[model samples]
Each structure stands twice: as structure tokens, then as C-alpha cells.
Target chain A: MKKKLIVKKNFLMSLFAVILGLIAGAILMFVTGSNPIEGFYYLFRGGLMNIERIGNSLATATPLIFAGLSVAFAFKTGLFNIGGAGQMLIGGLCATAVGLTFDWPKPILLTVIIIAAMIGGALWGALPGLLKARFNVHEVVATIMMNWIAYWTVFYLVPLYLKGPFLETESQRIPMAASLKVSWLTSLFSGSYINLGIFLAIIFVAITAFILERTTLGYELKAVGYNRDAAEAAGIGVNRNIVLSMAVAGALAGLGGATFYVGFASNMQIGVLPSQGFDGIAVALLGANSPWGVFAAALFFGLLHTGKGFMNAMTAIPPEIADTIIATIIYFAATSVLIERNWDKLNKFRLALRLRKSKQESLEDDSGGEQ
Target chain B: MVDLIYQLFPYAIAFTVPLLITSLGGLYSERSGVINIGLEGLMLMGMFVGALIISRTESIYPGTAIWIGLLAAMLFGAVFALLHAFACVTLNANQVISGIAINMIAAAVTVYLARLISGSGNIQIIRGLSRQTIPILSDIPILGRLLFTQTYATTWFVLLILVVATFLLYKTRFGLRLRACGEHPHAADSAGVNVYRMRYMAVIISGACAGLGGATFIVTISGEFNGTAAGLGFLALAALIFGQWKPWGILGAAFFFGFASTVANVSQVVPMLAQIPGIYLKTFPYVVTLAALVLSSKYSLAPKAIGEPYDKGKR
Candidate 1:
């Protein structure tokens, strides 16, 4: 690959956002009367210093990766897939239900559960897409309502059918046969919770990249996103593409649900909508809505999350404030488009200044030659 | 049946007042061509600030502190919402994304600040608004028994706001200008309206009202702030949409959701609703909202340029 000092446009912009986010986080630490350098040092050390921490970071990043892709993919097709949490919930619920109920062989059951999760998530996702496409209803409201629906569904169903031995809040743990952890993988990682989900996440990353960059479906979807009326006038079925994009987005988040409830940790808990779903929005924005960009952004966010507890333990800053730092980072990341726009304007101003200097220099040369 | 009706109605009104106020707040922002999904965060800001004020002043003013809390909540809510306003309105950020950031930040910041102030994450409001009977209205038979008896002073205050909000939205030149900005901002500009200023003012006002709603929530329901409005902001947004972006329509929607929420909260307390599962009751409003969005949205008429950032150069 040819190397450039600034790299690509979206990646460069995202890098700027990341740097800005870190500086903002540091400022927050400073404001709270903590040493920013010391805080950041331990934060990185917590997520990367040990093999277990590395494995744990990758494990934590797994769901975020899928959720980011879900949001990013739909974004490419002009759909804001804010329902990642609901899709993840429904997907996790279906996967857990399958994992606990089935007695099938390992590969078969895992495959079945994964497929069920994708389907369940797809249904939840496509509903809002369909409404937006057909009726012009806003996706944000529909998806938010769907989140509550999924929340209540899991809250209701877990206790009624999947209750564990002691806890009324969580579903029964998955049996070893249906679990995502292979003995070799666990040993290779030295007893970490990192499972098959990480590999699957990498594979899906490549698959999404191919689907987005190399397919006619991707072209059609992008055409719709760029201008729906123009796409429709050009003979593209904008409505179909919208729903299809959301389904694909939902499928990715569904896989993440499998990663979370079955792979990283077993059993679904009631009452809490997965914060990863909202975090996906930040990830997607920071990544500039690209699949590979989302992968990197998710890993970065994973480091922040994994390192946070350690950052808290070593400093006067409490965990709640640490969480506030993460949120502040997200707040800045979301406004990165502002930074990008300003950067573009600044570039234009520089180009104009350079042209004016060149014009003045040529005029001076002409005058000197005449003299 | 009358007794059951009597019991649920007062509870429903208590619930309705906040939802109504919040939805009205949302209406101002949405009507000015900005989507204020920050209502949730704004509400949380109100709850946090209001509860903080009430907690800190519990000893100083003891009896009148809750009213002071209400004022502090509105001011603080508007202040925090200024971040969102600056992002979406001035910087031309994606309104939904900005709103989501505001919501996430509000939850975290409130908890963090509460922890810093009280040395714990939880901020408790020792005193809250007590239910009061309107002396003359309480003796007026059906109306008094149904609407005036055993209600918080907040119910009347919110009602007064609703009437004022409706009058201002329909009868004032400012409302017309705000509505014009939402529908056709370029046209409004050509008509010599300051679209940007109107939107900013509407959003700030929206934040203030939502904060007041949050104050009412803690005052009427929780009696304490633990860093969430429990999705009441989203429910307010839902009411804004369900009411078809009109004041009367939003009131009806808020009333419906309020009753549904009351049912969910009071299911165990009420003998008839106790037999139903808690999950179903909790899920009812969401399901109904989704169905309503699906079935009625085709006929819905939103402000023409609602979610887009206005560019002076663009046609």
C-alpha cells in the first residue's frame, strides 16, 4: 500500500476526532483536579498492559464492533439504525432461548441460535425502516419505542421461562455444549472470556466491507442514500433498499447480541437496555460510518471502557466521573462534523492564499523582466 | 366502579400534567424547525438540579424549598440544553445525534456531579410538593371531587402553563414566526423573520419547560432524584408526535399516555389491574405508540423543513 502523510480523508478526520476526544477527556480530568497524564497512563496500561487485559479488551470490543457495523451499514443506505439496542435485545433473547432449550450438537445449535438471533433482530429493525419508507414516520421515535418493547419483552420472558436457580433478574446460563467458548481458544487466550465472537466479528467485518464496496446492491443503496428522489427517478426502489439496509444492519447487531449474551458472558439481564447500543451511535459517528473505521473505533472505545475502572482505582476521580469522561468524549465525537466542515473551509482559505501569492510572484517577475 | 374511576382519574391527572408540560415544551422546539430530542436529558437536568436545590436547602428554608428547587431546575436545564442548542443550531450538527449525546451526557454528568456534591451517587430531596385541595373547587361536586381534590399545586401550575402555551402558539406573532421557520425557513427569512434566533429561543424555552416537567416528576412521583427521568422525556416526545404536533392533540396524547403510565405504576395498588402482568402493563404504551405511528403516520403532516439545518445559500 502506498503511504501518505495524512492518509485518507474520512480516516484523517476520524483520527482528528479521536485526538480531540482524548484531549477533551484530559481537560475533564484536569478540571476535576486530577493529573491528566497519570490518569491516561494507567488507562492504557489497564486495557493493554497484560494478556488478560488485552483479551478482555477484545472481548468487550466484540459487541461494540457488531453494533457499530449495524449503525454504519444502515447509514450508508440513508437509514439511521438507532434501534441497535432493541435489535440486540431481541436477538439476545432469541439466542438465549435457543441456547437453553436445545439439546443439539455444538456447531448445529450455535448456528441455529445465531440465525435465530439475526432473524429476530431483523424483524425488530425492519419495522421502523418500513414505517419510515412507506409512511414517512421518523425512525428515531419508532426505534426508541421498539427499545422499550424489547426491554419489556426480555423483562417479562426471562422470569417466566428462562429463570435461573437463584436470580430472578437473569435468564438461566447456557449449557457448555451450546456455549461459544472452545477449550482450545480459552487456553490459547489463557483463561479469558474472549470467545468465537471475536473471530466472527473480524469475518463479518470483511464480509460487510465486500458487500458495501464491491456489490451492485451497495451501489444501489448508496445511490438511494445520496438522493432518494434522484434514485427513485433513476429507477431504483428506494423503499425496498431502505428496509433491506435496516435488515442487514439489524442482522449485524443480532450477531452482536449472540456475542454478548452467549459468547462474552452468558444470560440476559432485565431492565437495562444495553448501553453498547447507544455507544454504537458514537462509534459509527467517530468512524464516519465505514465498516473498517467502525472496527477501529469500537476497539478504541473498548480500550476506554476496559481501562476506566483501573483509571478510577488509581485516582481521586470516581468511576461515575470516569463514565462522565467517556460520555464527554462521545459528545465531542458527535460534533466532529463541525470540525470537519471547519477543516474544509480552512483548506479552501489556504488554497486561495497560495493562489494569490503565486499571482503576485508572477506579476513581480514580469515587472522585473520589463525593467 | 365510581370509586375505581375516582381513584384512577386523580392519579392519571397527576401523571398527565408533567407529560403535558413536556410535550408542550417539545412542540415549541419542533415547531421552530428543530427536533429537541434532548427533552429527556433536559428533564434529567431539571430533576438533578431541582433535587439538588431541595436537598441543599432542606435546612435553610425547609417549607418553601421545593418551589425554589423548581426555579433552579428550569435554569439549570436551560443551561445544559444550551450545549445541545449550540451544537445543533449554531454548529449545524445532526440534531438527533446531538440530542443523543446530550441525553448520554446528562445522565452521566448528573450522577457524577451528584456524587461530587453529596459524596455519594444518589441525591435525595428531603422535602417535596405536598398534595393540596383547592378550597372552593373541592366543594363543587363532580368537578371538585374529580379534578381538584388531593392534587399537587403543580397540577394547577402546569395547567396554567398549558393554557398560556396554547395561546402563545396560536395567537401571537412570535408563534407564527416560529411555525414559519419550521415549515419554510427560507420563506420565513424572506419575510424578514430571524429563523436562527427563533429556533434558539424556542429550543431554550423547550428546555425550560422540560426541566419544569422533570421537577414535577420528582415532586409528584419519585420524591427524590437518582439521576434519571425514567424515559419520561421520550414519552413526552411520543406525546408530541401522537398529538400530531398540535397543542390540543398533544394534550389528548399526553392524557392517554399518562393514564397508561398510571395503570402501569398502580397495577398492584388497584384491585382490577393487579391480575394483569407487570410487563404487559409497562409495554402497553410503547406497543400502542408503535401501532399508532404505523397506522396514522401516512396521514401525518409534519412541518415541511423540520429536521434540516437551514443554509442561507441553499434554495
Candidate 2:
């Protein structure tokens, strides 16, 4: 019971730290003659003013949700998936290929492209996962290297592979058949080109949460993350969990890639590949690696990004400041030790007070008995 | 045949020097078990600051002194990385996430700070190091022209650092302690070695080395900083891995990468290769780096506790 209270205190301290960092940043801005209140007002109004703006936000949020989920999922099985960017890239390119090359019924074509993207992403993700599981290789090194490989591989291969009308230095336009339509929910988004992908993203998060929280597989995975030797002793297949978690994580990021092709851009070039995968890491960290937390974090990042255009339209403040804010939050949030140490102090104070009260009660009882 | 080898030699040596120096810098941090993902950021900051100082001073000797100015940038990079270390080391945060955060923050901060200073993202018109030819070897015909004809002060400095770093990591008592802290911090702590201090030292060394590499780039090649350390951090990272996290091994690997890079750029300029129809040849260096990374995947090993933070009580 005391332990639970300590955990709560640590959390509160970390929260306060983030608040302090924000205040410091705001003070800096104020001293520089940039009104903090006005800057934030511009930020909010520009980000969530109306249905169109909100739709733009969902469009931004969809990929991040997948990316955050990817990182969070991998975190559960004791692996770090730095290759999310690469996996997403592979997924993007694969989806683009399927979108351009295949001819099918509209719904079927869209499904095929999404599946292809997932497979591509999964394959990319599996390589590093397998290497680590089998060879005891460091995933951080492998995944980071893989990111560059994906970057240059796409750089070299995309031009050769892409075909059709949209195929210049940029990618080909995705077929209408391969596009995910949001015709049903146009009222919420006001036809801003944001589709049902936001719902899909939410559903994906739910699925991941459910799998991690309820299933035997989830229990086994969590066990491994906590302690590999203990998990192995408990008869859990540690290697399998590591590989499976990475594969599923990659698929989530792949879906993020599909969302871009089918729901938003309909065309992607090399540089245009969104930093969603990288941003997802920040999102997952900010959310403390919980799936639901990741969903909320994704929304926050989405809001920040969508508001960029709005912020630029309204104020001289660079939209990149929002990213700086996010980085600061992560920095403050990551320093949980300081928080834990403070909480420990608070717990010790409470314990001492409790002990003194008990002693006084005993003394009172002794006096009454003597009388 | 003679002409081809002669043309290749200068380009290879020139390019190899930077990669060797930078990757060797990467070795210090990684060997001590802090994955210095901020190497690229430090290099970028170093390049920018070093360029500005050298340009304002207008003397290569003072330009050489601009490396001291890079200590501020290195400290900046270290503090930036302290964010990562705090996350990964203190909070047991995921290493890759912390790293990516550092990369993002570094990129944004460097650009933002650069804009504040120069009114532009790109800093130009910086004074650079003039390549000095060896006094006695200038007349030694082909070999002299290839090996000793012209290079930055950093080229020789890197060679010397490599020898010293190689010794420091392997021969020195400090090296043994640093390696012990990385591999088994609890043991190191029990032995009264300051584990945290060692890790911080490793990371700071990485920042400084990365700074030197960045400083060298501005002073030698670019004469201006356009964030020319563009993705070179990853290349240095690749070299580190390809070298299997060993100092001498990484130097050789970096040299290979350097050779490939120079060949790619120079090959494009060659009249014969220029006649080719595709851009594939231009992308050869990145392709090689990719291949090197993938092929070395099986062999590269990290310290036992490379990314894990030391928690004495938990132990």
C-alpha cells in the first residue's frame, strides 16, 4: 500500500517538473517580447478552431498513433524499435507500389495495398528483431543502421519501380480504388480530406491494448520485458515474444504508412515521407509507453503539428517551437529519478508521522489503564 | 593504370581522414557503453561554431584555436545528450527513443541557434585550413603527393588520436576501469570505481571527438557550414558497428567508408562515369554504408550493459 502511494508521488513530481520546464520556456519567450499567452492562444485557435482544423489534426494524428503504438508495443517485449521510420518507409513504398500497379475493385485494391504495406513493414522490422533474438545483437545499433538502409534503398529503388502518371521525381498518384474514403463521416471532418483512418488508428490502439492487457500472449510478453531469465524460467518463449512484438509493431507502423497513401497524400516522394515514426517515439515516451497514453499523446502531437500552419498564419513565432516544447516535455518527463527521489522523501515523512501517532495512542491507553 | 591509382589516392586519403577522425571519436563513447547518437549533432554544432570563429579571426592559427570555441558546442552537445543519459540511465528510458529525441532536438536547436546568429540556416564565407605539404617528402614523387602532399591539421591529429585512443582503450588502467563500468557496473561500483562519472566521461569524450570531426570539416573541406555533417553521424555510427565497436577496427571501417564516399563523388565527376544514364552511381556510398551495416549485423557486439542504466540498490 505504501509502495503504491510512492508510485503516485513519483508521477506527481514528474508532472510538476514538466510544468516547471514549460514555465521556464514561457518566461524566456516573454523576456524576448513574445507574449506567451498570445502565442498559446494562437496555437489553440489555429489547431482546433473548427471541423476543418480538427480534420487536419486527425489526418496528422493517424500516423502518429500507429507509430506510437509501434514503439510502445515493442517496449512491452523488451525491445526498442528504432527502425520504425525505416519500417514505415518500407510500408509506404510497398503501399505506393500496390496502389499504382494493381488493378482491382476499389475496396479490394485498398485492402491489398494496406496488406502489402503491412508485410513490407513487418519484413523490415523482423530483420533487426530476429538478429537480436538469435545473435544477441543490439537492436539499437541494428535498427538505427536499418533506418539509413531504408532511406537509401528507397532513394535508389523508388525511381526504378514507380510507374504511371504521378511518376516524376515524385511517386505516382494512388489509384482512387486504393484510397480509403471518409464519405460516411464527412460531417465531423467537414470534407477536409481526413478520412476514417483516425477511427482506424483508435481501433488499432484498442486492439494493441486488449492484446497486451487481457491475453496470455500479453502476460508472457510483459514477463519477458520485466525479466528475461525469470520469463524463460516460467516457460515463456522469450525469443518468440521478442520477434512477434517487433512484427506486430512494424505492422502498426506499416498501417501508419498506408494511412498516408490511402487517406491523405495519395502521393509520396523521398523527402515527403513524414517524420511520424520518429515523432511516435516522442509520443510514446511522453505518454509513458502505455497504449491509451500513446493515443492521448498522439492527439497532442497531432494538435501541435496541425496548428503549425495556423500558428504561422497568425504569429511570427516559428511552428518549430511546438516541437521544442514537446522535446522539453520529454526531457523533463524522462528524468523520473529526481521525481522518485523526492517521492521517497515524502514517503519517509509520512511513515515517521504515522509511527509517532501510534506511539502517542499507546501512551494514552497506558495512562487510562493506570488511572 | 598509374593515372587511375594516382587520381584515387588523394581523394581516398582526403575523405578517409574525416571519417576516421569522426568514427574514432565515436569509439570513445561507445566503447565505454554510451551510445553517442549525438555525434552527428555535436559535429554539426562544431562545424557551425568553428566556421564562425575562424571566419571572424581570419587566421588559420587562430582558426586552429577555433577548436577551443568548439568546446562550448561540445558542452552543448553533452548537455543535450545528458538529456538522453538522464532518460536512459536514470529513468531506464528506452535507449533508441532517447537517442531520437536528442537527434530531433539537436537538429532543431542547431538550426534555430544558427538562424539567430547568421540570419540564415547556412553559414558561409568562413575561413578554412590551408592544406600543408610535408617539407622533405614533397619531392618524393607519387607516394609523397598521395600521402603527404596536402591535408588539414586534423588529418595528422586524427592519426595521432587513433594511436592514443587505441592505447587509452586497451593499455591504460583508466581504459580497463571504463570498460569494466560498462560491462559490469555493479562490480565496478563494488570496487569503488565511480560508474556514473565514467559513463559521463565516455559520453563527453564522444561529444568532444564528434566536435573535432565537425570542426575539421569546416576548416578543411567546406570552408562554410551547411550542416554538412548531414547523416554523417549515422555513417560514423555504421563505422562503429562495422568495426564491431573496436577502435582500430572502426578506423579501418571508417577508412573504407571514406574511400567509398570519395569514389562516389569523384566517380560522378569522371568523364566516363558521367556518361552513364542513371543516378545510381551517385548513390553508391550510401548503398555501401547500407550494405556494410546489414552485412555486419551478425558480427557486431555491444557491451553487456551497453544501454542499461546502473542502479546500485537494484543490483
RMSD of 2: 3.9
TM-scores of the candidates in the order shown: 0.95, 0.87
- lDDT of model 2 at position B242: 72
Please give me the DockQ of candidate 1 compared with the native complex: 0.65
Which segments of candidate 1 are over 4 A away from where they belong? A1-7, A353-371, B118-120
Q: What's the distance in Å from true for residue A166, model 1?
A: 2.3
What is the TM-score, restricted to chain A, for candidate 1? 0.93
Candidate 2's C-alpha runs over 4 A off are A1-21, A27-33, A163-169, A181-188, A191-193, A271-274, A351-371, B1-5, B51-97, B117-120, B126-132, B138-142, B186-192, B221-229, B266-301, B313-315
Model 1, residue B225: displacement in angstroms?
Answer: 2.1
Q: Residue A292 in model 1: shift from native, Å?
A: 0.6
Docking class of 2: acceptable
* Worst ten in a row by lDDT for model 1 chain A: A1-10
lDDT of 1 by residue, A88-122 (tens): 99999999999999999999999999899999999
**Model 1 lDDT tens row, B59-139:** 999888888999998888777878887877787878888888888888877876776677666777776788888899899
Output the number of the TM-score-best candidate: 1
